[model samples]
Target: MSTTTVTSTPNPSVFGQSVTYTATVTGITAGTPPWGDVTFVIAGGPTIGPVTLTQTGVDSGTASVTDSSLAVGSHLVTANFVNSSDPLDNSSGTTIQLVNQAATTTTVTFVPPAPVCGETVTLTAHVAAVPPGSGVPTGTVTFIISADGPTVTGTLDPSGNASVTVPALSVGTHQVAAFYNGDANFAASNSPLTPLAINPASSTTTLTTSPPRRSAVSR
Candidate 1:
């Protein structure tokens, strides 16, 4: 009888990264060599060739394969070893691998970086998935003004952008930022703080004094 064990270099692999799977075969019979080929298969994915197993000791051999094109999700990997001399002693083992989605980033911008008091300003947030992964960001983005000011939420559009208009803000320099509540495909992210200066509104006054001196002179 023979026992087969399988393992992956990167158990929790990321999308688009190569993962090496190694299988070790050991024979129960003392002093007997376990010479043969090992085949690897990924459920719902690709299958690797029957690579020749290299003898390491009197009763053990090993085989390996590298795969780089697996979808992002959970998958089952199996390794099978069959020796021609010991057909009845063939063995196989299974393991699970988790492939996670790539990371994402968030950026924010104000239509007018600076604005005066009581002026409307538009705040926009753009969310995108990092390279190695491609998709439009979905979900809601919350825009905040200053540290303890008003907060508003907006849903992402098809272009991965969300915007909200602030009716008015107090006079002073305020910090603006946006937070993206991630969806199923992407992770949550926060944008850097943006400095906004709101200057006080300007006003003008005029006064007119009638020609009282001319009326006194005429009397």
Candidate 2:
């Protein structure tokens, strides 16, 4: 009988990237030889050519195909040896390929770095995909203050930025963070806490005098 083994290069492939699948066929009987063409197919994907294999050993042959149009996700690849002289000797094998979404990063910034109590502060969240990826990040970003202070949400714009003005914050140091909910092409990410200082609001005093009015009345 004959046995087939299948393998893929770049096991963890990225979307729209090229990948190569190889199939090897070997005969179980020492004197028997496995020859002919091998057909490769990807489950829910494109079907490769039925390439002829070259015999290297007693009954061993190998074939390969390269494809780049597979969609992003897990796919089952199969290789079939259908040219064996005996129908029972024909063998097939299967392997798996994983396609991952693009990586992303999130960042948060404060317009004024430092603010005063009872003053409005602007918070901006920037979401960006790592290199080798296409398109900007979409969806919303949730901004929250450490120590469970407050939470604000903003939708990302075309430029992958979201901004919101927060109400007055208490006087002290605060750690602000942003979370990206992610989209179809990018993964979710969280930004590091950004420290912001809020100083106490200043106070004003007033003074009044009635000496001139009192002197005129007495005269």
Tens-place lDDT per residue, model 1, 1-219, is 799999997878766557889999998787887878899999867899698888888989899998867767889999999886767889998889887765778898887776778788898999987765556778999988885458999999999999998887888888988999987656789899978788898888999887655545654
lDDT scores of the candidates, listed in order: 0.84, 0.84
For each of the candidates, give the backbone clash count.
Answer: 0, 0
Worst 10 residues of 1 by lDDT: 210-219
After best superposition, candidate 2 residue 62: deviation in angstroms? 15
Give me the displacement of residue 171 in model 2, in angstroms: 1.0
Highest TM-score: which candidate? 1
Task: Name the regions of candidate 1 deviating beyond 4 angstroms.
Answer: 1-11, 15-72, 77-95, 207-209, 213-219
- Show model 2 residue runs off by greater than 4 Å: 1-9, 15-71, 75-97, 132-134, 212-219
TM-score of each: 0.59, 0.58
lDDT: worst 10-residue window of model 2: 210-219
Model 1, position 106: C-alpha lDDT score: 85
Q: Give one digit per residue, the lDDT tens place, for model 2 in 1-219.
A: 688999998888765557899999998778656777889989878888788877877878898998866656899999988764666778899999987776778999987777899898999999987755445778999999866368999999999999999988889989999999987657889999889888999999999876655545654
